[model samples]
Every structure is written in structure tokens, then in C-alpha cells.
Target chain A: MIWLTWRQHRKQALFTLIALAVVAAVMVPTGLAMHHRYERSGLAACLADLGDAQMIRQSEAAVHCQALSHQFQQQYSDLAFVAILFVILPVFVGLFFGAPLVAREVEQGTHRLVWTQSVSRRRWALTKFGLVGGVTVVLAVLYAVGVSWWFGPLVTASSGRMGYLSFDVQGVAPVGYTLFAVALGVFAGTLWRKVLPAMGAALVGFAAVRLTVETLARPRYMSPKTLTFSPQSVLRPNPATGDWVYGQGVRDAAGHLVASGAQIGPCAPPGCGGVAAGSYNWQLYQPGSRFWEFQAIETGIFLALTVLLVALAIRRLRDIA
Target chain B: MTTNDQGAHTMELALETGALGKRYGRAWALRDCSLHLPAGRVAALVGPNGAGKTTLLHLAVGLLRPDAGQVRVFGRDPRDDTSVLAEIGFVAQDTPLYRDFTAVDLIRMGGKLNRRWDAPLARDRLASLGIPPDRPVGRLSGGQRAQVALALALAKRPRLLLLDEPIASLDPLARREFMQALMGAVAESGTTVLLSSHLLADLERACDYLIVLQTARVQLVGAVDDLLAQHRTLVGPRSTDTGTPRGVVSVVRARHTDRQSTLLVRRDDDAVIDPAWIEHDVTLEDLVLAYLAEADTRATRTAWEVTA
Candidate 1:
């Protein structure tokens, strides 16, 4: 059975190999260009000057200013590239492992022969799913490791903040997301009983969920803002007066008051409460706590959902007769 | 397994159906299709289109479950026993072979699936039949594919071979060749064969036992020679006895001719010699036709009476 499966997937395996080779081929030249730019002079000088900012602030002398170099841009691009790599990982995994796995069998009607053989339908479904599912997980993990390695230098330089930029290996979110999407593709394929339609459904579904999460869910994940304000003569003013607003120029048209932004003020009417609350630039409060906690919890959630969908797929295969 | 005080010739039976029946919704496809085929003999299952020939074959092969009664292959219930399937080689109608596989690949799959595979015999037979094994099955002509399918089934060395229209699509020459190959296989292996076909000529050439079905019922089942010798169509005048006639097995069909009565009876001796009537010998085709015609008439006119 294992040999038969391998033989059946030979074409898919070849396609995956070609795709990976292309990616590796493109990445090598890109990596070389990046290495070259980082070693050049202008970019090198920017890093050298970044540390000198503290030194120059205290001295008050017009020091020789160094420009940010090509190396900095290269590093920035490298950091951004990691996210792009992972966003498309699920698509590749779905194409190779999920698309034809069950749908092809049902479409070809070869499943009837297998179903009527000595093996029970449940065992048959489980064997195929287990074999393919194990391979998919392993491949996903390998891809995650590759993404981490290829962008490790850039990520560490930018700290975990690279995650906010899209492709950072900050938490377990990427792994969970890819596994969920691949399993969802398999479920769709099984339900649809055809290859092209199932692939289309998976693509549309993945895109919709991703867009919704990025646009709608992001605001709830964290609210970031920037604010600048001076301290009082004796002590700090009320913290509520410095509400951290998330976006730029968020004040209403007449500019009477800012509807969004974090601020603190007294509750009285027109007294010390509204003492022209010293104007300040507001930055939304960043979620500093529970990062790993959320990662672990959401990882479990997505993985559990994946297992459930796969179980449904297996159960449905029994009635294919 | 001997019985009382009789020197009757007995043979080991290959297949038996005891009041077998199947129904789909309101219609019955096979009702009380009881039959028996002794081992090492070929049985031809004959019926017109829409008759229960294929349904009976499917029931016998365990591919279909009977709604009532039972079907036994080699004295074992086919539904519950995979052992029965192992002993039977079934060639389904239209030859369902994997298109991507070559003849060699099909035989290899058969070898893996069946416990007893005569690989050498299959290869040699293909060679003798002038069939190329390396070509894909889809590329082969219908006749060639049928031959390949036959080889696959025969390689199993089954005790009983059940075929459904094994040569319906073949040209006359290919059909003859297929029958010749099947006959050679059976003669060499002593395999019991049961085939259902609408083509009477092919059945005439290859089969020894006969079963005729009409309107989802078995009209007649017996040895070919015995059936031919016992059944006769007797035509006479109206002054004839209507009850069971002398030297008669059964009154299969009877009708009143112009001032005469024609009776089709299953009797070996000369048709009843009444000076007032005329008797004639019955051909196998005429004998089978009379039963079919009678069965059709009975089905249409037999109405159920409702009681208050």
C-alpha cells in the first residue's frame, strides 16, 4: 500500500521538487545580492552612526554625520521577505499533499476496488490519511525551520518586532495557521469529490479568512500609537490625559477632541478635569503580556480544529460506496 | 453423501439457490430464482433483455445481497463467506479492467489478490491466443481486452467460473476464439463454468446445462440433453384429454388449434398417441421459447384477489 501510494504521487512529488528547486534557486541569488549590499560602505556607515546617536546627543558638537547604507535596506528587505515566504507556504502544501489525496481516488472510482477488498473502509481511510497527514506535518515543520534559518540573521537584528512586519518567527501562529489551512484543503477536497473545484474552494476560503483576520482581527490583537508630552513642574500629570491613539490625525474634522487614543483625566465638569489636558501624541498600548500564552493556546485550538476536519473526512469516506 | 437404494448418477454441485429473491422498491428483479448447477459442468443462463439473468449471476457471485432466501456457491453462503469468492472467478459484463494497466500488470494484480494464481498457464495462454501483454489495456480492442480479462480470471484457477456476457461485444470470429479458449481452459482444468448471455448460439456451442428465466423467474432449469429429450410440442384436434398427459413430465404450454389442441409437454417418449390428435417433436429453441412465452402470458394475467 505504501509503495502504491508513493507510485501514485510520483507526479506530485516531481512537481514539488521542481517548485522547491525554483525557490532555492531564486533565494540563493537574492541572498548573495543581500550579502554583497551589507558588506558595502554606505549601508555599513548607517549602522556605525546608529550607535553614535546617544554619544552625539550629550556632546552638542556638530559631528560628522554618517548615512544609513545599502546594508540596512538589504536587512530590512530580508526581514520583510520571511513573512511573504510563509504566507504562500500553505498554498504549496495544499497543491502537493492535499489536492489529489482523496478526491482523485473518488474521481477515478478506484476506491471501489479498494473498499471491496479485504481491508475495511475505516482502516483504508485511516491508512491513507495517517500516511499523508504525517507527511504534511513533517513537511510543514521543515518549511518552518527553513524560513527561520533563511531569515534568522535579519529577525534577530530587528528583534521579535519583525513579526509585526509579517514574517517573523516570533510565535507559533505561523505553524498553526499553515497546518489548519492544509487540513482544511483536504477536507474541502474530500467533500467536493473533485480536484479543481476543491482547490478553488480552498484558495477562496483561505484568502477570505486571511483578509478578515488581518483587517478586522488585528485591531483587537494590539493597538499601537505614538505620543509626546512634557511633565509638570512638580510631578507627573494625570496619565489619562495621554490616551494612546492608534492612527495618525485621528481627531475629528473641527478638531475639538480626539475620539480615539489613550488618555487620563479627572471626572469633574470644566474644573481640574478639563484643564486643557496638556496635548500630547498618543500611542496605543502594545500587548506586552501573554504573547507565548496566546501562541500556545491558539496553536492547540487550530491543531484541534484540523484534527476534527480530518476525522470528518475519514468518516465520510466510508459511505463512498 | 450417498442416499437410499438408488443408482442415480450424482455429481458434486458447484452452485445452488434456494428460493433466492431480490427486490428494488416495488419491483422484484429476481423472485424465487432457485437453481442448481453440478460441479464440472457448464450452465448457460439465458433470458431476454430486462430479464433477471444478470441479477441472478450477481446474487450467485455475492456481489448483490438477496432480499429474501439464500444463494449458495459450493454449498456455502456467498454473502457471509469470502471463501466462496475465492473459489469463484467472475467476469463482469463489459470487462471492467483498469485502463492504465497493461495485461502483465493486470495479471500481477490478480496474482497478488488471489491465493491460487496460475501465472505460467496465464502467460502461456495469452501467448497462444496471440495477445500482446505489454500494451496498455485501454489501447487494446474490445475483443483483445475480453481475452485479457479472461486470462486474468482464469489465472486464479477458480473452481467455478461465472461470466456475464463474456463475448457480447466481440465479432463472430473473436467470439468463437474466446469460446474456444474458454472451452480449452475448462477441459484442461475441469473448472465448473456458469455464463449468462443473450446470444443463444454462443451458449449452444459452449454450455451443457441450461436455465431459462423470464419476468424475473426461472422458467426451466436442467441438463441440455435431458431438457431437449423430455420436452415436446404435441398438436392435435379438440377431442383430447386436458389433465397431465401420459408419458409426460410436465405440461409446459398448451393451446387449442382449429378443431385441434396443441400441447407442449416435457416427455421423452413419443407425444401422446391419441388417434384424434397429432404430436410433433420440439426443438431446443422452440422448447425455450414456449416456456418464455408461457411465462410472459402468466405474468400479465395472474392478478391478485383482494379479500374484504
Candidate 2:
């Protein structure tokens, strides 16, 4: 069974490696260029003080190179390209790997032969799940390593901001999500017993779940907190309700201070006038906080959901007409 | 013809159905289809379009579940018995070979997937048929594909072979050749076979036992020679009298030609043919048709009786 599974997945496995190579081929040069630019721009030294850069130099060239590196960090923080790759890989996996896994057999009526063989339906399903699911995890991990390498210089540059939700998260989420999608594809193929419909259902279904997570779940982690304080040169109490208004300014209709004060939210939503406290605005948020925790929790949740979907798929295969 | 203990032991039947039935929603594909095929005999399931012959074969091979009753292959439930399945080879209708695999690949697949496969036999058969192993199964002509499918089935070295319209898509000459090869293989291996076919002539050539189906029911089933012996057609004038003789198993059809009465009847020895009518020997084909016609009349009469 394992050999059969390996034979079945060998093509997709090669395709994945080739695709990853292409992505790396393009991103590697861009990454190296950015690293050179940031080091030349002194941004490398600036961030290097916060992190590590074994290749640091203090010349004009190094400062400009460092600036390019910093710029790359700032510009690609969203990891938009990598995120799109991650978001889309699962659909392709489901279409190429999951849909054909069962639908072809059912359509061609070869499943009858398989079912009647010495292998039971449960064993067949288990073998497929173990083999394909193992491949998905391995592929996901490989993708993570490749993208992580491309983002290596920047992640080290950004210090901690690059860890939980930056390009790393976007790039790695696809791996996890594709695992989920493959499971979904199996379920759809087994239930529908056809390829096109199964592909559509798996793609649409996974996309919906991903979109929902991105919208409602992701923002909670991305939103920054703000805290405010006023100097003794202006510190005073509020006349109304006797609440101490530290910055000695009139409160606005929206309950904000009329002037500069502490603001604790993800970077004051454009046009809001305020100064946040507890660390200079220029300083990056401290890493290893609730942010990393959220990422760990979210990943665990997605992986669990993927397992559940795959279990349902296995059950469906056993009872398929 | 052996006396007591001197006789050879009779082998157990390879397949047995007890009132087996299958239905697709309101339509009964097969109903009360009971049969028994002992080891080392070739039985042909003969029926017209939509006669549930394929349904019966599917049930017996465990590819389908019966709506009622049971199917046993070699004394074990067809669907639940892995040991039985390991010994049964089936060539489904249309010969669903993998389109992507070469003939060699498919043959190798059979060897790898099946526990009892004979790879040497498969290769030798393909070589004999001039189907080079390297050619993709999809590239082969329909006749070649059928031969490949037959090789795969045979290479399993199965004790029982079940085929559903195995030669339905082949040309006439190819069909004959395939049948000949199949008969040769069966004769050499002594494998029991149950194949469904609409071609009565082909079935006549290959089958020693016959199971005829019509209108979702088994109309007649017995050894081909036995059925021919038991049934005869009588023709005279159209029976103006509605009453049928007591021993008449059935009146196959009624026709009026120039005031002469003709009746095709299945009867016991007690049902004497009228001296005015002519009694003729019935071929197996004639016997099958008479049974089908008799079934149709019975169905129509029952429907009217219920309505009345």
C-alpha cells in the first residue's frame, strides 16, 4: 500500500519540488539584493544592533545595502506574493492529488476491483490517508523551509515582527491550509465520486474557510495596543466627572483627547492625532508575547480541523456506494 | 453410473444464489434469481436488453449487493468472503482497463495487486495474442484490449471466472476468436465460468448450462441439452377455445393464419398434443423464446386479473 501510494504521489511530489525551486530561483536573488542594499544603507547596522548580521560592513556601500534590506523588510512585510502562493497551493494539491485519488477509481470502476481484493476498504482508506497526509505534511514543511530561507535576512532584520504574522506566517499558512484542502478534496471526491465537482467543492470550501480565518481571526492578532500619558508640564484633572485627564486637553466628541495623548491600538487609524506610551512609537513591538501564542494556537486549530476533515473523508470512503 | 463408494466425490458448487433480488428504486433489476453452478462447468446467462443479467453477475461477484436474498461464491458470502474473492476473477462490461498504463503495466498491476496472479501465464498469453507489453492499453484496438483483459483475468488463476458481456464490443471474427481462446483456457484449467451475453448463438457455442432471464425474472434455467429435451413446440390452428389443457406449462403464443390454430406449449407427458396439430422438436433458442413469451403472457394476464 505504501509503495502504491508513493507511486501515485511521485508525480505531484516532483511537480512540487520543481515549483518550489522556481519560487526560490526568483526570490533568492531578490533576497540577496535586498540584503546587500540594506547593509549599504546603515539599516543593516541599525537592525543588526537589534538582531544579527554576520556580513555587516560600515562603508557607504554597506549602509546603502542595509537600507535596501530594511526597505525590503518594510515593503514585503505582508508577504503578499508568498501568501498568495500558500493560499493557492492547497487548491492545486486538492485538484491534482486529492480529486484524482478516489474519483478516477470510482469513475473508471477500478474501485470495484480494489474493493474486492484482499485489502479491505478501511485498510485502503487508512493507507491512502497515511501516505497522502504524510506527503502533505512533508511538502508543507519543505515549503516552510524554502520560504523561510528567502525571508531569512529580512526576518533577522525585522527582529521579532517577522516571526508570527509577517511573510513567515503567510508563507507557512499555505502548507497547513493545503493539508486541510487535501483532506477536503478527499472527502469531496469520495462523496461525489466525480473529479470536477470534487475539485470545485474542495477549492470553494477551503477558500471560504481561509477567507473567514483571514478576516475575522487574523485581524485580532494584527491589531496593536496603545497606552497614553501626559507630562507634569501639563498634567491636570478633568472638570467634568472629576476623571483625571493627564494631558490637560479637552475631550473630543469621539471621547479621544483633543490633543496629543496615549493611544493604544494598532497604529492610530489614519488621521487620528495621538502619541502612544510604554515604548517609543519607532520601537518595534516586543516579540514572544501573546502574538506568538496566538499563532501557535491558530496553527493547532487549523491542523486539528484538517485532521477532522480527513477523518470524515475516510469514513465516507468506507461507506461509498 | 457408479455404485456406492466407488464413485468420485462431487465438487462443491462454486456459486449459489437463494432468491437473490436487486432493485434500482422502483424498478426491479433482478428478482428471485436463484441458481447454482457447480465446479468446472460453463454457464451462460442469456437475456435481452435490460434483463438484469449484468445485475445478477455483479451480485454474484460481490460488485453489487442484492436488495433481497443472498449470493454465495464457493460456500461463502460473495461480499464478505475475502478468501472467495481471492479465487474469483471478473472481467466487467466494457473491460475497464487503465487508460494510462501500458499492457505490461496493467499486467504487472494485476500481478502485484492480486495474491494468486500468474505473471508468466499473463505474459505468455499477451505474447501469443501479439499484444506487445510495451504498448499502452489505450493504444490497443478494442479486440486487443479485450484479449488483454482476458489475460489479466486468466493470470489470476482463479477457480471461478465471471464475465459480463466480455465480447460485446468485439468484431464478429474477433468475438469468435475470443470465445475460442476463452473455451480453450477454461478447458485447460477446468475453471467454472458464468458469463452474460445477448448473443444466443455465441452462448450456444460456449455454454453447457443456460440461465435465461426475461422481464426481471428467471424464465428458464437448466442444462442446455436438458431444456431442449423437455420443451417442444406444437402448431396447428389458432385455439378458438380459451381453455388451456391441464398439463400445459404455458401457451407461448397464439396466432390465427387461415383459420388454423398454433400453440407453442411447455408441457408434461400427460399433455397429449392434439392429433390435428404438428409436434416439432425445439432448439434451445426456441425453448428460451417460448419461455420468454410464456412469461410475457403470464405477466399480462396477472395484470388484467388484478385490475379486474
Candidate 3:
């Protein structure tokens, strides 16, 4: 069964490996260059000292670091698009490899040949799904590692890792996403039984699920922690820690949360003209320390959905005739 | 039960069905089709288009589930047991082969999927047919592709082979060649075969047992020679008025001209004949066509009665 799976899908597997190799070839040199620049410019030390009051007070050091950060950001800014492409990579896997896995066989009437063999339909489906899905996950993990390593310097210097774009493409999320997408493709293929239509439906279905999870489900996994500070403090989240700031607002002395960008005059007490004495602004955020927790939660969701879809696909095979 | 050459009593039927049926949405593709084909016979399932021939064959191979009843191959439900599946080989209606796979790849796939795959026989058959093993199946001609499908099915070395319209699309020469190779395989292996074809001439040439299906029902099932002997065409004057013969199974067809009446009847015995009537032997083709035509007229009459 393993040999049969390999023989049938070696083309897809080879192309995927070559594509990953190409990505590695392009990223390795560029990543090394970025690391060399980070070391030479001393931006690492500057970033490390960003929390020091004296470093911020030193205008010359601040200016130099800002210039270095700008250069690094400019050089690696294209990686943001690459991250977006990485986000769509699983959809491509679902569309091309996953969709055609069963749909093409059905459309060409070859399932009659394969399913009627000594291998039972359930076994055949399982072998194909397991083998292809396992390979997809491995490739996705490799891609995640490569992209994360290539963008490590940029992430440390400019954008912290907890942002939307970085959160998804790094760590174990991409593997989960790939698995979910492949399962979605198989389910769609089983339902549609036509290759192109199955691919289209899988693409649309994957996008909907991904977007719903990212926008609606992921944030509510844990109630965000809130921190209150005087209005004199910076209005933005702490840049040193890459916490995902959900929202910020001001609260009056009575502890009622006020709309953001509201007139502070109503709540400002005596001697609070320059900085509000009574009204304090609060930050609602998921902290960077919970990155692994979030990854585990999101990956679990995708994997559970993947298992459901695979089970559905297998069950549906019995009714195919 | 019958004793084989080894003196072992055997009651195993190659295929059997009881009230078997299948439906596609509101329409029944096959309905209440019960049949039995004993082992070691070349049986042909003859039907018109949409007459449920393919449905019956698919059911026997467990490619399809029956909606109403059961299909048993080799004395057990083919769908429920892996052992039953292992003993039966099937080539579906379209002769579907993976277009991208080379002949060798298909053989390799067979070897991987089947426990009793005969790799050497497959390779040798392709070689003897002058089919290049390395060429992708898509590049092969239709006839060659059909041959490859046959080779794959034969290489499984199953006790029963089910072919659904295996040669429907082939030219006459290719059809003869395919049947010849199939017959040769059957002779060597003593395999039971259930083949479906709409071409009566093909069935006449290759099949000893005949099953005629029409309108999703079994119209006739018997050995070819027995069916021919049981059905006789009687020609007489229109006024003879042989209302209904005794010991008749069914009046298959009746036509009356100005002064002559022709009737095809299924009878149990060699009854005494009317002196004025001439009895002629029925060919397999004529017998099948008569049954199909009779079935169609009966269906139409039933529809008319319902409307009335």
C-alpha cells in the first residue's frame, strides 16, 4: 500500500519537495546576510537596550538604531508578502494535491478499478489519506522552520512575533493548517467528484474556515488581560513585548470604560490638564508569553477539524456508488 | 448437489441473487432481478441500453449495493466479505484504466493491491499482445486498453470474472480477439465468467448460458441450448386460433397477418404439433430479441392500463 501510494503520488511529492528546496535556496543566503547586517550594525544591542531609559534619552543612539531598523525593515519587507503567500500555501496544497486525490479517480472512473481490487475501499482511502497527509504535514513543518529562521532577525528588530501575519506562518500552526486544508480537499473531492470543481470548492471552503478562525475564534480562546496606566503613559501597547493589543480605552473615576479618542476634559481632575489624574487608559491584550498556548489551541482546532473531515470522507466513500 | 471429477459433492453457485434491486433517485435501475449461474459456465447478461445489465454485474462485484435484496457470489455476500472479493475479478463497463499509468505501473498496482496477483502472466499476456509495457495507458489505442484491462482482471487469478460490456466499444476483430483471449484464459483456469453485452451475436458466440434483462427486470434466464429448445416459433393460418398452448411458460410474441399467425412460445415439453402449423428453431439472437420486444410491449400495455 505504501509503495502504491508513493507510485501514484510521487509526482506531487517531488514537486512539493522541489518547491520547498527552492524556498530554502532563496532564504538561506538572504537570512545569513540579514544576520550579518544585524551583527555589524549593533542593532541587536540597541534593541536589547530599548527598555533602558538612558538609551531612549540618548537621541544619537536612538537615531542610529532607528536608521538601522528602517534599513532592515526595508530589506526584509517583501517577507511580509511571502508570509501571506505562506498563508495561501495550504490552500494550494488542498486545491492541487488534495482535491485531485479522489476526484480525478472518480471523474475518470478509475475508482472502479482501484476500489474493486483486493484492497477494500476503506483501506485504500486510508492509505492515500494517511500517506499524502503525512507528507503534507512534514513539508509544512519544514516550510515553517525555513520561513521562521529567514525572518527571525526582522521579527526581533521590527515586528515582534505575536502579530497576525507572524503568528500564523511561524511555529506549528502551518502544519495544522496544511493538514486541515488537505482534509478539506479530500472532503470536497469526495462530495464533488470532479477535479476542477472540487479544487474550487476546497479553496473557497478553506478560506472561509481560515478566516472565521483567525477573526472570530482565535481571540476568544483566553480572555485578554487588561492593564491600566495613567494617561501620561504612552497610548500604544508596550513595543518591547509583542502582545496582541485587542483594544484600548479610557476609564473614569467611577470605573466606567469610556470610548477611545473621547474628550478627556470631562474626566480630568485638578492639575490634570497636561496628564489626566483621574482618568486612566487601559490596554486589553494577549501577551507574547502565551504564544505557545495560542499555537496549541489553534493547532488543536485545525487538527480536530481535519480529523472530522477525514472521517467524513472515509464514511462517504461507502456511499459513492 | 453435483459431484465433481474428484467425487466431492459441490453445491456452490458462481453467482445468485434474490429479489435484487437498485435505484437512482426516483427511478429504479434494476428491480427484483433474481438469477442463478452455477459454477464453471460462461454466462452472458444480455440487455438493451438502460436495461440494468450493468447494475446487476456491479451488484455481483459489490461495486454497488442492492436497494431491495441480496447478491451472493460463491455462496456469500460479495460486499460483506473480503474473501468473496478476493475470489472475484471485475472489469467495469467503461474499461477504466488509469490513463497516466504505464502498463507496467498498472501491473505493479495490481500486484500491490491483490494478494494473488499473477505478475508474470500479466507481463507475458501484454508481451504476447505486442503491447509495450512502458507506454502510458492513455497513449494506447482503445482496443489495447481493453486488452490491458482484461489482462489485469485475468492476472488476479480469481475463480469468477465479471465483465460489464467488455467489448462494446471494440471493432469486430478486436472483439473477437478479446473474447478469444478471455475464452483461452477461462479454459486454462476453469473460471466462471458472467459477461454483460447488448450484442446478441457476441453472446451467441461466447456464452453458453443466457440472461436477458429488459426494463430493469429479468425477462429470461436459462442455458442457451435449453432456452433455444424451449422456445419455438409456430406459423399457421390466422383462423387456427391456438388460444393458449398447454405446458407453456409464456407466450413471448404473437403477430397476425391477413391469413397467417406467428407465435413465439416458451414450452416445457415437446408437445404434439398442429398439422397445419410449421415449427421453426429459434436462434439465440432471435430468442433474446423476441423476449425484449415482448417485455417492451407488456410494459407499454401496463402503462396504458394504468392511464385508463
Mind giving the per-residue lDDT tens digits that candidate 3 earns over A1-321? 888888778888788778878877877898898889888878788777666221124346666776788887887788657767877888898887789988998999898898888988888888889888878877888878987887778877775777888888888999999899889999999999999999999999999999999999999989899877665433324354667878777787777876674423222234456543477766678887788999999999999999999999998888776
Off by over 4 Å in 1: A6-9, A19-321, B1-12, B19-32, B50-53, B65-67, B77-82, B214-217, B237-277, B291-308
Measured by TM-score, the strongest candidate is 3
Q: How well is candidate 2 docked (DockQ)?
A: 0.37
Give lDDT tens digits, candidate 1, residues B1-308.
12211211366679888899988788999998777788888889888877888888778767577888988888897653656767877787777666777778767766655567788878898888788889878799989888887887788788999888889999999998899989988998899999988867788867888899988999888878777767677776563465766667678887876687778887735445444445676777788888988887777676433221
lDDT of 2 by residue, B142-234 (tens): 888888888888888988999989888899998988999899899999999999888788878788888889878988776676666556677
Each candidate's interface RMSD: 4.1, 2.4, 1.2
Better of 2 and 3 by DockQ: 3
Q: What does DockQ give for each predicted structure? A: 0.15, 0.37, 0.73
Give a tens-digit lDDT track for model 3, residues B210-285: 8999999999987777778788887877854546655555668888999888888876564665556678898888
**Which docking category, incorrect, acceptable, medium or high, applies to candidate 3?**
medium
What proportion of the true contacts does each candidate reproduce?
A: 0.00, 0.31, 0.72
Residue-level lDDT of model 2, residues A68-93, one tens digit each, is 55676677676645645644766787
How much lDDT does each candidate structure score? 0.66, 0.69, 0.83
Query: Per-residue alpha-carbon lDDT of model 1 for A7-91, expressed as tens digits?
Result: 4566667886787788677666765555555546343343343342211231111222122322354546644755676677776
